[model samples]
Target: MHTRRSLLLTAAAGSSIALLGLATPNATALAATSDQGLVDEARITVQDFTGDTQFTDMRRKLARAKGVFIVPQLLKASFIIGGEGGSGVLLAKTQTGWSEPAIYTMGAGSIGLQIGGEASEVMLLLMSDKAVEAILRNEFKLGADASVAAGPVGAGIEAATTTNLGADILSYSKVKGLAAGISIEGAVISARHSRNAAYYGKQAHPRAILYENAVSNRGTLELRQALAAAEMP
Candidate 1:
């Protein structure tokens, strides 16, 4: 058990470093980019997910989602021990529309023999206010801080929709441009306060950014519009 835990921790840290643009000592490219870049990617991701026929069930859930977390590119690579990490934004549904996005990071690791690499688009539908509240904290853990279930896909989607409704969050992912089942039960999500500050030009708590309407950006309008369109019946 200790060995497994160590592997997970190591993998998780590796992923964080990679996402922060430190994958290599002399690597010219930075994984973390401008806030506007992330927001743009998020808009595209939402459009891609909602427009896909494969995600018909996800659209159903989005219509009733209390909030949504969109991660445009979750890069998962492993030679033996595996890890995945990406940056994303969380938006809450408001009386007027979706709130401006708050910056966040998601990472997870696994202890197994695996040899592959993939970049996936992931979205987590916050089904309950409790789920949104937990995520508003400094850190939240899936399957610990909140109940999470994978959103249904493929032929069984219709039957599976009736299940997992009681969960606080429903997670969906697309790999290589097609829907795929993903297991992120042990993932850790942390607030990217520095990035948020950079994006909003001031430090603000996630609660304020997401709930209190303390900040707004003209840049995120398109992303908000895309999400609102998806939520519409």
Candidate 2:
């Protein structure tokens, strides 16, 4: 009777190990599935932002924008001495469309207590040939070297400014899903193309993805079409 009991215990342990081995692949697949969904959701968010009034205006003002870096929701923090924020996507426009997102970091060590916590959408219009060139090199700061300014807003073209710092710079803002008439200035933007590419498992830049003719899903396409209509001449 002891020998039979020992045999049964051994069989149960072996079965448990086999079951665990089978479950491993399913677990890995589930993780991959979740990540894919996240990427798709991010793309949808971009398309939604484009349709927003403020974002639409910014896009129209900078229609000729060669590169656009979009961070869906940028979290900002500030204290008495200094503050910092990191990990956003830098998307560059290509001949075809907008490129895949290149990860980026932005922060400044300054003195001030800008006590607030809000999710902001930052749009960088690369106006200088020098700025564009610098992005290709890697990641570079906006106000650190290049002149960044707040963009104007209105329905009429006359309301827009034609001033260019070797190229034109247009920026806009939105608060809690409402379009803010003011533009965001002083904030810096930089690209981390290498890290971004790694995240996407590609050797390409965000600009490449922007320009591609690939059709975003139904929701994205609809949003793009709406923004296009609003921005039409």
What lDDT does the true structure give each of the candidates? 0.82, 0.48
Instruction: Quote the lDDT for 94 in model 1.
Output: 82
lDDT of each residue in 1-233, candidate 1, tens digit only? 22432344345435445556443433212222355667877888898888888888888889898999998878799988999988889999988889999989999988788898887889999999999999998999999999999998766678877788799999999887888888889889999886676677667998999888888789899999999888645
Cα-based TM-score, every candidate = 0.85, 0.61
In order of listing, the candidates' clash counts read 0, 10
lDDT of 2 at 122: 50
**How much is 199 displaced in model 2, in angstroms?**
2.6
Query: Could you say which candidate leads in lDDT?
Result: 1
TM-score of 2: 0.61
- Candidate 1 weakest ten by summed lDDT: 23-32
Q: What's the C-alpha lDDT at position 130 in model 2?
A: 57
Pairs that clash in candidate 2: 96-211, 97-210, 97-211, 98-209, 98-210, 98-211, 99-206, 99-209, 99-210, 100-209
